[model samples]
Target: MFHFRRSTAVACLALAPLVAQAQINVDSISQDALVSTPESVDCTLTDGSTATCLEITVKYVPENLEVGPFCPAMIDDIGGIWDWDGDEAGLYRIDAAFLTMLDEMGYHFYDEDGTVHVFDIRVEGPTDDNECISGSFDEAVEMTMLIPTTPVMADAPVSLGTVAKVGVSLSGVPVFADAPSALDTGHMPALDVCAGHVDPGGWYHYHGTATDLDTVYDHAGVEGSCANAIQDAKVQFGYAFDGFAIMGSLEHDGSVPRDLDECGGHVDGDTYHYHASEEFPNLPTCLVGLQAEDNYSTNAAGGIGAEGKGPGGQGGRPDFAAMAEALGVDEQLLARTLEEAGGPQADLAAVAAVLGVDEDALRAALPQRP
Candidate 1:
């Protein structure tokens, strides 16, 4: 009896070469940056400043990949992948785990299908407002994604085989207190802590708030400089909200009845919930350590070592590099370059030169700054 398990998309890729006639084909890839045009939002800062917050955007279109059954096991009986991974029969489990992990690393996932399966993550300075035209059916799918602020190095003579893995880290701290002197450039554009995660390799990432969910104090805090070492890498992130929501006054005040109840307290129209790895013990291993923060429920990137407690356990976050391998993305070159760059924002020009794309184009591809 063939007791079949839902084969993860990553596992299929590893076995593809050995099998005949593979179905998934990542046809054409095109990208653009939304950095110059920031998403201005009214948000109050940790230091008590109410300013129009800026967000970046990045958009891309992937040509062909048999759209049917990308991950069949996780889909719901209704044939949609948005069944909240099948949690709480009533609520739509937004890929909270995936989104949280990405957000922890400064990335946001856009619900392309109006359901929760995220096609792409937003980086610092990146948002999602683009459409993807399917090459197979020429059907344009309207979707949203998180943007990045910097550029990536995928063009030119770069060796696809050289990339061994993509490393991403995310964190959220009071904008004023957590931001280091390295990221203290005056202009908010330059000072946007999100851009600090961009590298010459052009992969923009982040470790802050989301467009919808805001980081609150009751949750765990971000620790150390885990992001201080990877470069040209992508960071997952989202927008930060002050009180009950960004629109509310009394910044950081949990006084509001709903605010004290944590997000998704009563499940209003905008309420979103996701399962954490701890909650769904039956989830695929491939999906387990994929990202630090998955979305609304969990935090990612090596759990912060409680304030004043020095770096905790092993100093790294979830093993996304391993996940990248499962995704069939080049990891070797990715690893070496990041190891040498030290941090995402360091020496971006040189990194871009090495990757071979024009600096402008590279930055545009980044999800954060788009």
Candidate 2:
């Protein structure tokens, strides 16, 4: 149970600009051509046995091609070959020319297998054709370029309903949203959208994605992180990634952005895209930040729309079971506390504090103990 304060969230969003937020391209090639002399050649093994080999030649474009984010992963996906040995079927290196094509198309390398590998490539102008097979003479070949793989598929965009919990934090308190399986969107796909601009108290906030969350919090100033603390609050409950339902049934309705400056005191730029879910139920193309729904209100102790109940035994408070499940604690402990409360007022605030909820809301949940 991490105690999340507004300061923590604000600190994290300030570091967003420093992060690498670029998109990659692959599947594009720019090269002159491939030419081999004599077309084929004969090779002899250590035992003195000879075999026919093809002489593959290629000319690259741009002289230097950039490999996108998927290249390494794709190679690893099918299995990478370090040595220039096409001996095994389906193991072949794309000549430097082909790499240019992939780079042009935005292909990047990734290593999904959790194993790190290194690849290098050296580019040189075409010289004597004899030099092509020279490296094979002693089994020591000269090559250019070594490419490594990046972490691949660690996080995939999954529907909210399939995850055990939506990974998010609010006011620094991490709550699990685990109702995806039970809630049906009714043909409207829902996506959880957070305002990259303001906090629950209507303060300017930033940082919208998990990647940005880690960067901003760890690197930004404490004050900045505090402002964004509410951003972490979640509508879903649970640690399992599959707890919340994704609004997959959402439709893209083009609409102008609605300013939220009145609520959070910030002017977030407009946006236009597809969306579902109560948060950002309407896709505003002009104002991206305004499209977000204010899900952080649920955690306030005495707030009007707060979700979970407090430790006190009373009317609007959550049952011992629901509170236990939401907080990831044992139900018996809360149940016992409720019994020992003696009265609602004495026990309510204490219960909410322990449960990480607001005190006012906790008191509201408890029934008057006449």
How high is the lDDT of residue 136 in model 2?
6
Error of 2 at 8 (Å): 17
Candidate with top TM-score is 1
User: How many clashing pairs in candidate 2?
Assistant: 102
lDDT of 2 by residue, 15-65 (tens): 112222111111111121221221334433222434332222222111232
Error of 2 at 170 (Å): 17
Candidate 1 lands at a TM-score of: 0.18
Tell me the spans in candidate 2 whose CA falls farther than 4 Å from its real position.
1-209, 218-349, 352-370
lDDT of 2 at 204: 18
TM-score of each candidate structure, all chains considered together = 0.18, 0.16
Looking at model 2, residue 9 earns an lDDT score of 19
Candidate 1 lDDT at 68 equals 25
